[model samples]
Target chain A: MITVNNLTKKYSGTTVLNIDSLEIPKGQSFGLVGNNGAGKTTFFSLLLDLIRPTTGAIENNQIKVSESEAWKPYTAAFIDESFLIGYLTPEEYFYFIGELRGQNKADVDSFLAPFEDFFNGEILGGKKYLRDLSKGNQKKAGIVASFIGNPEVIILDEPFANLDPTTQIRLKRLIKELADGNDVTILISSHDLMHVTEVCERVVVLDKGEMVKDIQTSTETLQELETYFTR
Target chain B: MLKQFISLQWKSFFRSASLSSNLFFKILTIFFALYLIAMFTLLGGGIYFILEEKVQKDPLLIINQFLIFYLFIDLVFKYMMQKMPVVNIKPLLYLPFSKSKIVHFSLWKTILSFFNFIHYFFFIPFAVVLIIEGYPPGHVIGWTMGALALIYCNNFINVFLNDVDAVFYSFLGALVILFGLHYYQIFDVTVYTAPIFDALFNQPYLVIIPILLMISMYILAFRYFKNILYLDGGLQQKQQEAKTESFDWLNRFGGISVFLKNDLKLIKRNKRSRTAVIMSLVFIFYGMLFFTGAVEAYEGPVWRIFAGLFVTGGFLFTFGQYVPSWDSSYYQLMMSQNIMYRDYLNAKWWLIVIATILTTLVASFYAYFGLEVYLAILVAAIYNVGVNSHMVLWGGAYVKTPIDLTSNKKAFGDKQAFNVKTLLLTIPKLLLPMALYAVGHYTIGPMLGYALVTLAGLLGFAFKEKVFDIIEKVYKTEKYKTIAAYKQKN
Candidate 1:
């Protein structure tokens, strides 16, 4: 389980992310939704310890994320292109990430074998560096590389944003597979409420750095999210 | 259309993200430029008098004999240093302007480069001296104009030189062969320059040849750029074939070697880091320039050791300074990974130490300079691997600005403007070694000097674990700041 307790991040005395308490149980598919300044990324940054929180602690599986590196082994995230090495081929990048996670090249190769459909014949065995790839292809590389070591927690921010419709559907299925079959805890942040609702077991709405609603996903969840946003 | 393009470029320059930080350096650069202009002017004005006292022949004929050599050196220097300043044509390509006009404007822009003006800095003063010496103004005009046409021709030729690596190598190889043939007294390669330049003064119309040559080069450059001006052509970087190599052998060393292999790939794959690697190679031969001169020219162990330090520690100076920033493109990925700071820093230190050792081995041939010279280099290399490498990595922890690997196209890519902090950090790295060696050399003895350097290095090697702890602490404390800085748009 991940516990975010009294986490608040301020930029020049202006609070950006303020959360009193939030619990994300292991092996659950959780979704985060918000507008541009609603602090979705700020919250994620604090969770990853990429930025320091003004006042609070985040614990990942009983280990404080900032105080120790123990969480990094069991946690994986793909926040943006900053997470990808631009100069490496997708395969090299995969092998690099695999090696970091204590997986051998053969292990990475096998893990990536089924991802060909998701790669759409463009990523692996190709000469193009990640930077040269189209944005959707680069995201595919980043997202799939996050899955290499089979980390218990996977965090993906806006995974379906730039993707083509076909690839978007493929990614949704991939997320569902990890959430259900592999017993992985998945945290997804997306502006596309329809996609997030389809994949997440529970979805939370963040309004200007505060949680406004936390609801269980059901058949009418997409409509509920759409109605909230439209209003 | 040209005015609009110029205005757009001006706005981009002032509005650049780096402009605020680079403003101080810009002012410094202006003073540096003034110094060069002054030096060139002095050289031009004094050339006649200097030659009159030294050479038996007429100064004009003697200098004319060397004009081709001067032009060759000028062209090569410009090839190394000059960049076409502000004609990024990609955005302008889709505009209403004709493609040829854009190409023409780009070509015309090079004519205004400070490089072309340097010829006047030297030649106009030389012309004044000629006129003062009673040479006809008409002849001087023809000669100077012809000389400028050739220089501009070189400027245009540099455009083609950028695209053809083979041609560049051939130019270098050809220079070596020509210099070799001259060295052996087999031929005088500069035999033709005197006549061509003399003909410019005698038959003023002969200037037409150089003018024609300049026009042809301009046309060639314009046509080449125009051909590739299409949106999907040369302006768009072609996807390169991913060169894959199995680093399976490095798996034995575990995490450290993984970073080592990845860093090796970083240097191999990125344009900026690769330039740093090649520059280190160029500095390896820097010893030859001083070593080939008479022994008395640099008699002391100090100068010999100085050159040796450069010979052996070249890669350390060149590539070590930009340690973590070379990975700035993917630094967040590294920081967020499960990799330990100890492993990452140790891997970098090892890579540079290995490079120093390799360069030292290459310079062992400098034993031809004598065991004394080579031993000085060996001692310095040992010191470099042990001490200087750690110092550089320490400095790297503070590099707040990130290097944009793909976009840094400066010929001196190591000096490419990003951080003054990096430039400042290089000082202690350079001075500490020299100061340590010099202090021991001056007070105690040469043996103690070598021993001091060697001891310093050994101590650094011994305490590296302690050093790494400090470095790691700095990394942890600065983590959020580095992440935020690296995320800034280049």
Candidate 2:
């Protein structure tokens, strides 16, 4: 669980993200939606404490995100490509993530087993490194590795942008399954309204650094998103 | 369309110029230009003076040998220049220009590099001196042109070979074979160059090989345009192998395992950074060679210890200077994660310790080689732990150069911007250790003096965490300054 209160961030005198209060319960899928420069990414970054907030605080699993030692073992995030070590192969990358999380090596291999067909030995247990793989494959590898150790909270920024349609649906299904079965709270921010509606139980619409709407996906129709997007 | 492409190239080049002209670039330009001129002056003046009187008798042999040597040196420079990160220019590919023009421009830009100065600084001066001393003007011009052409050819050839990965190794292989042949006198290149030299000094037709080689280099460089056109080759695809280090070596120490991994990675991947490791070892070798003579010359164990420490640890401080820059791109991610600044700083400390330990081992080998250098190594190691490590740690913590580790440029920060503070710190941190050693030789003698160093180092180790915290506080407070130091366009 995560709670952000009275959070504000500024860069060069311009407010980039401002939040009064927000909470993400355990075992739920939360979608963050915004147009370009809408502070969605900034909000995610704040929750992870990547950058210090101008004011206010965040608590993840009861530990203050900025001040305490929590969120390390219980949370994982892929803010951008910097999160991925480009030199390591997919298998090696996952193993690295596994080791960092204190998971056994076999656990990593078992987790990767289902994706073997998609990976085709191209991404894992192969001569090819992550740097050599195509962009889609690299993204898939990064996504899979981010989920290593089954953290209580997983935050992914623009998780489906570069993926092919088939992989997109597959990943969506995978995310839903993880949120439903493993009791993992997942926060995925993307512009794809259809994708968000399909997987996320609730969606937060942000515009110009402020949260404009927080609505249950079950109640709000797809057409309602057009208003937030246009504004 | 071609006109549009050329315009685009021009704009891009000028944009790059703006970026490069940052304060860092200006300092680098001044330093590099001065250093280059100074080095060439020393080397060129020495060779020219040595050969000036002899060239009147047999100038061709001398000129030819010089040309070959120039070509050899120029070839190494060419390889380094070609490897510089023009790969980032891929963003320009989406612009309206054909890839062919971009490659052509890149080849043309190579001539602008500083390596072309072997002709201007060394050969032209030799030619001028020869002409002034009564060699015919035509012969002098021919020789100068030939020498310049030969250097250009070598530069182009190296650039060409670098495009295909096979070229560098093949060039190395050919060099080895040539060295073997020359030593055995089976085929004497010096003898071969005699006629060309004679033609240049006595006659003027011998300039043809250099002329032809120059033309061939242009052709080869043009051919490389095709290779650059299709940038996807096995060269770029060379992947990093997964590290399978047995941390049993470092893990026993506890909390140092991650640092061990990072240290190993830095050596394995960063070619320029690997130099720090090799340089430390080379100094150790030099310490062994110079120890006896140095002792005889100075007649003091203190002098020996001072010399050993400086020689062995010359490259020490440069190790941690790029700490933030090395991880700048991912720092946002790492910062976001559960990683504490303290743990991050501790990891860096461990890397320094590992490097220092490795240097000490090399120093130990110097002891085995009959110099009693192990005592000096012990002293140096202690100084390294007690003083040098903190010096570097603080220096690195304060350094702001956000180095791109993937680039061919050494350290990836500013090439020419050495801070006065960094320079000032070196005097005391490095020289004081030697000064202390020197004082000890008179006051206490070698054994006691060396023991003093060892004890101080051990004590420093005991209180290292406290020292690190103090450094960390300074680092945090000066983080913005540090960022500016790294980011200032050097």
Predicted candidate 1 versus true structure: per-residue lDDT over A1-231, tens digit per residue = 889999998899888888999999989999999999999988888888898999999999999889998889878899999899888888889998998899988999999999889888999888788888899999999999999898999989889899999999999999998888867899999999999999999999999998988999999998888899996
lDDT of 2 at B159: 61
Question: lDDT per residue, candidate 2, B1-490, as tens digits?
Answer: 5465456656765665234434564565567668778767665546656665646545545656656655775675466443322333456567776667766665666666566764587666666666776768898788778778877787677665553435665675676577558867797766665566566655566777778989988878776555645435412434445543334455565544544554565556654455445445545555643565633555555666666665556456555555655665345545545455676677777676667777776556566545456677767877786767766777666545555454422211112222223344466665666666656667877666676676767777788788889887875576444433443332
Per-model TM-score, in order, reads 0.89, 0.79
Residue A21 deviation, candidate 2, in Å? Answer: 4.0
lDDT tens digits, residues B272-390, model 1?
67667776887787787667774456666666666777788777877788777787877778877898988898888888988998999888788897776777888878777887788
Clashes of each: 0, 7
Question: To one decimal, what is the Cα RMSD in angstroms of model 2 from the true structure?
Answer: 5.7
Q: Which stretches of candidate 1 lie above 4 Å from their native place?
A: A5-21, A53-59, A62-67, A181-183, A207-212, B22-31, B86-88, B112-120, B124-138, B201-208, B294-301, B406-428, B435-449
The lDDT of each candidate is 0.81, 0.66
Best by DockQ: 1
Calculate the i-RMS of every candidate, to one decimal place.
1.2, 3.6
Q: Per-prediction DockQ, in order?
A: 0.70, 0.34
Which pairs clash inside model 2? B24-B489, B24-B490, B25-B490, B60-B197, B400-B482, B400-B486, B401-B486
Give the TM-score, chain B only, in order for the candidates.
Answer: 0.86, 0.71
